[model samples]
Target: MNKWQKIIGVVVILALIVANVWAVMDYIHLADTAGAWSAEITQKSFFDCIFSFRQHFWFYTFLSIIDLVIIIVLFICLWRKGGKQ
Candidate 1:
């Protein structure tokens, strides 16, 4: 892959991993602290923020997969271009 595409792919993967992890953490925290969750909903606590973010878990995962596909395509394109040269 080109340097830029590779960098983007890495960044995307990291972001997705972080998001998924946060989703898991938020899910667990919500389950653990039942009453506190509503307070968080009112005040917008960290766990609440994460809870909102969890909504995009599937979306981010899809984007991460797309990023991987792009990286693969980039490598193939670069390899073909190099071969022609």
Candidate 2:
């Protein structure tokens, strides 16, 4: 039988990589869409882009938090499983 824990670990790493890449891609897109996520309010000042940036990245941030929790939980489970062997 396969070491399911090892498989799960590999899957976890891959999932994290994919998630972070996706987040970064969207971040780039959002920034580009927002003109580098900043706009001129005056010759020397930029408009408030914080809210828009936050709004754009909120879902990705949430997914990262969820991924963190899942990774922690999976590691705990795998550790216990390994210990039993």
Candidate 3:
């Protein structure tokens, strides 16, 4: 990948991480307010909680998935070029 592609890829990765972190935090806050799911959430795995947000946050989930695919494609491209700068 060229310099700009590398920058874009990093930006995408950072955005994905930030969004997921925020989502998790927001979910935790919601659970606290619910007074019921607070205990149930502990029983569930971390990924399970994230997946539960899919329907509620479809756009975010969709964008994250697309960013992941882009990252994978970028990795493949780098591999094909034998890691040459």
Q: Which one is best on lDDT?
A: 2
TM-score of every candidate relative to the true structure: 0.43, 0.57, 0.52
lDDT measured at residue 77 in model 2 versus the true structure, 0 to 100? 83
In each prediction, how many residue pairs overlap at the backbone (N, C-alpha, C within less than 3 A)? 0, 0, 0
lDDT of 3 at 30: 51
Candidate closer to the true structure by TM-score (higher is better), 1 or 2:
2
Which pairs of residues collide in candidate 2? none
Error of 3 at 31 (Å): 1.3
- For model 2, residues 1-85, the per-residue Cα lDDT tens digits are 3699679879878988898888889888866655654554333222355455676667787887888898789789879989988
Task: Go through the candidates in order and give each one's C-alpha lDDT.
Answer: 0.67, 0.73, 0.68
List pairs with backbone clashes in candidate 3. Answer: none
Candidate 3: where are CA atoms >4 Å away?
Answer: 37-64, 71-85
Q: Give one digit per residue, the lDDT tens place, for model 1 in 50-75.
A: 57656565665776676688689879
For all predictions, the C-alpha RMSD in Å is 8.3, 4.3, 6.2
lDDT per residue as tens, model 3, 1-85: 4899779868877977887787777666655544435455453564565566556467657767877887789789879888675
TM-score of 3: 0.52
